[model samples]
Target chain A: MTESVLASWREGPVKQAIVDFVALATTPGPGFVAVADRIATFDNDGTLWVEQPLPPQFDFVFRRWAQEIKQDPSLAEQQPYKAIIARDPAFFAGVATQDPEVVGALLAAFARTWKGTTPEEFDAQVREWLQTVKQPKLGVPYIELVYKPMLELLDLLRAHEFRVFVCSGGGRDFMRVFAEETWGIFKENVIGTAAEYRYADGRIVRAEHALGSLNVGPGKPEHIFAQTGRLPALAGGNADVDIEMLEAARFSVLVSHDDEEREFAYTSGGEASLARAKELGWTVVSMKDDWITVF
Target chain B: MTESVLASWREGPVKQAIVDFVALATTPGPGFVAVADRIATFDNDGTLWVEQPLPPQFDFVFRRWAQEIKQDPSLAEQQPYKAIIARDPAFFAGVATQDPEVVGALLAAFARTWKGTTPEEFDAQVREWLQTVKQPKLGVPYIELVYKPMLELLDLLRAHEFRVFVCSGGGRDFMRVFAEETWGIFKENVIGTAAEYRYADGRIVRAEHALGSLNVGPGKPEHIFAQTGRLPALAGGNADVDIEMLEAARFSVLVSHDDEEREFAYTSGGEASLARAKELGWTVVSMKDDWITVF
Candidate 1:
């Protein structure tokens, strides 16, 4: 039964590339070598999972911000807050491209708001939020909507003795909230953007996270190299920004979204960024032609 | 030959604890718990290496300060600068204990000073310092004076499938400087006190870490629990501060410095601290009885 399931998915060029990668990683030799200690890095938003109107993290954050604004009317006057209050998702996402200064300021505000708590305190709040929050599109728990394929890939890589890491462009603390339970990736291995913390008065205090540019494609590889001092053995992505990270990997796979019937087809939209992974020499896995299942 | 070398060492209760730890970790289980993932945490400084007059890290910091001061004599007139110029090692170590406000103010000053640089830049500077710094007593490079027996134990644990880590009172950044080269322990796994960083001007800017209370013995367990969320299977320590960490481990070992004639016999001047470890029923190993070589 398991062999039939595996064989069912093994019918494309991308599948062949995956087979080759698995073979090299398992085979022991000098030339076709697989470094046992090798790590494989994957991008989160729009790569491993879906990123439509905005990433799920931003959706959660904005929702939290809206709740806070109800308690304090003054935040409505703030620039980014005002943009958010006006329900301008485009303006908020384009804050980096339009006026970069706002990005840093917004990040600082976000960091200051959540700094200096114990792990228990933070985790409890995250758990509470996850229990309460629901995805508008799916009408299900946000955690349930996590890409099933990526979860399987994570398990498969770990089985082969590969250290798989999620090098996301999302907030480190935010990603950490669900990373362990939802993905099985530990907090230490999950690298992302961070807000600062200040310890004082027998308590952990949040410092302003001077946010500016999110760690996108090229920056993903840069951060990984800085933290781990290693280039990944395998890398996966689904967008133009991910090209740099994939190019740096020994084996690269690109998931191309072409199944409109099974999954939402994303080409390029007025608000959303265009996908450009095809030009990066990545083994393109078409949703319709490559993957047997969307999940 | 290896057995003979181990037999030459004095036997102690902690030695047996280590043996038991190795045995339990290697025993196969449902999830494939192997020695490579056993994850043994160790304390650095007095535990793994010599830390007499002051930790070697402080020595480097003081020397660098002096060099910087020589180039700018005006620093002699400044408050902490004047104290630093006085060349009082005791005063320096007691800076926080003596005046809590001074530590906070100094950390603030450092945060402003280091506002825009990559982690790589700081790592490079630390590497340079390690290359130049020599231990006063051993006359060996500070990095080389790491206890030979402990090095073997790390290798043995790794051989048995244990992931060796450092959970110390020292600065996290300091451990990262040499853990990889000296012990094959990656920087991420070595949890310790840390200074916060801020992102500014396209780089990760480090702030001064004003550690109010060091991650001393009991605090060592706190650090490990808070950071990694995994209680170690085994831990080794040299002094009273090691007791808490040792106590938290499934199998704990304390290196008793009873061989005054062979190696420097010393302990942190705190009786109650070690007494607490004894009350916890932890395994204590006499160095004279447990180690064949002092390195």
Candidate 2:
């Protein structure tokens, strides 16, 4: 393979489809229709942005929660709030997002903190937070911890007219606040978990709820279809939660978090969803072998 | 005036900003930085796609209604359903999109005709319809009837990296489906009026209720805030309804549909909003004076 093809392999489907699709789309005969259609879906946490111990939004929220408790001190005595105040990682490990009440409350708190903030303000806030907030072990900005290869992949797809969307398991609106500035991605296109809203003083407000399910696994595709009627022609993800989204497309790939030296060698808890991805004809991207850079 | 600026003047505000924003975006040094920071917002109807003599979607609905009426004449005896059966232009004119009952019934009928259809099926149906569908007076494919100068503007904006978005009064999702193919604009960047949704039997269903107010006139700014949370540095629209959106921007312009001989010369029935846009310091685009071509 040429250096371009080698680079293409690392980037995933768009590069691979270019030549063939170009020929088909631009067939010389009359009645030749060129849709030039290229839709690419990305998993937000690990695929587009960073997701180390957990997704970055969760990390942000955890820190925010910790700060809230730091101010009150009494919150440390409550059940879930106590765990949040204590910064007890063990306490968080058992918490299930599927509990509608818990998720709803958290979602509400998140919406209050971020909603109605203009894009400029939000971008500045995201930039400042990413700069100051360091991953505990790595001692670098959280933004610096994003997968570099995936960033390259995003550019590669955009260059080929592939519209990129983040069908994440994260909060839908949270991604909107930062995606544009961090990755040049837009907010309207990022589909994740849905939240309830209310109207107050002639303005719409996202209501805080303590119960909701984390949009993951099956929910990725569900949210994607509900928000954007277009199924991606190409897609990528790091876990099995992304399989449904990938399966909905003509092209699919999974970024194997296997290179400990360059990045994190990790899996979500016990189940190895990446293994199942390979079994489904999805390309397994080995970080060590495939990437020249891994942020 | 420069050749480029003069060319832009004819295209309308939506088109002008694209050219100006793109030029500044690609220019070297501080010029690019200053210009790239300019956010350009576009109206979706006549401003982006073809919506004169009613939106392209209304044509589809009308056609479907006509077909159904031919099959079942008894349907003509109903109220709004009767209007649909008769293909009555007046009923379409009174399209009460905000009323849940009206929207629900229409959306149900629309879903019945469109759902479970593959992307291929949808696109083919649209393309075939486009071949015959024409502006009642203009007598041309709606796609072929797109404003050429506006198209040049879009290309110009993309060249600059100026963040562009479609903030319109039309359906939020429908704009996304054809925007990429029509303007080479990404789907995520488009924001418009929204509809509610429901999940049933492993399939997503469109709810008949309006998700929010029709994003027009004053509501344009509201939608932009809800979707992007950014007051556009630059924005454009074609009618009195677009005044609020254009006026809200730092650099704003209004496209006056005054050139009857070239394009269709007509005005939407409403209070004169373009006057307000002008008083608010928006640049007024004279269709007759500014454009060399009207697609």
Identify the leading candidate in terms of lDDT: 1
**Alpha-carbon deviation at A193 in model 1, angstroms:** 2.3
lDDT of 1: 0.64
**Tens digits of lDDT, candidate 2, B1-295:** 2466446354455445545644654567544545434567888666755567777766865787778767887766765567665667665555532455555566666665555554446556666676777778788777777777667666555555667888877666666666777777666567777655444343445544555566765667766655554567677777766766776776666677777786666667423656675466666666687777777
**A292: Cα error in model 2, Å:** 7.1
Model 1: CA > 4 A from native? A1-10, A25-37, A94-100, A108-113, A197-214, A217-219, A240-244, A267-279, B1-40, B52-145, B148-163, B167-188, B191-258, B268-286, B289-295
How far residue A235's Cα lies from its native spot in candidate 2, in Å, is 2.5
Q: Which digits, one per residue and each the tens of the lDDT, describe model 1 over residues B72-107?
A: 888667645667667655546554243565665455
Tell how far residue B167 is off in model 2, in angstroms: 4.2
Fraction of true interface contacts that also occur in model 2: 0.11
Per prediction, the TM-score for chain B is 0.81, 0.77
TM-score of candidate 1 to 2 decimals = 0.69
Would you list the C-alpha lDDT of every candidate in the order shown?
A: 0.64, 0.63
Fraction of reference contacts reproduced per prediction? 0.05, 0.11
DockQ of candidate model 2: 0.17
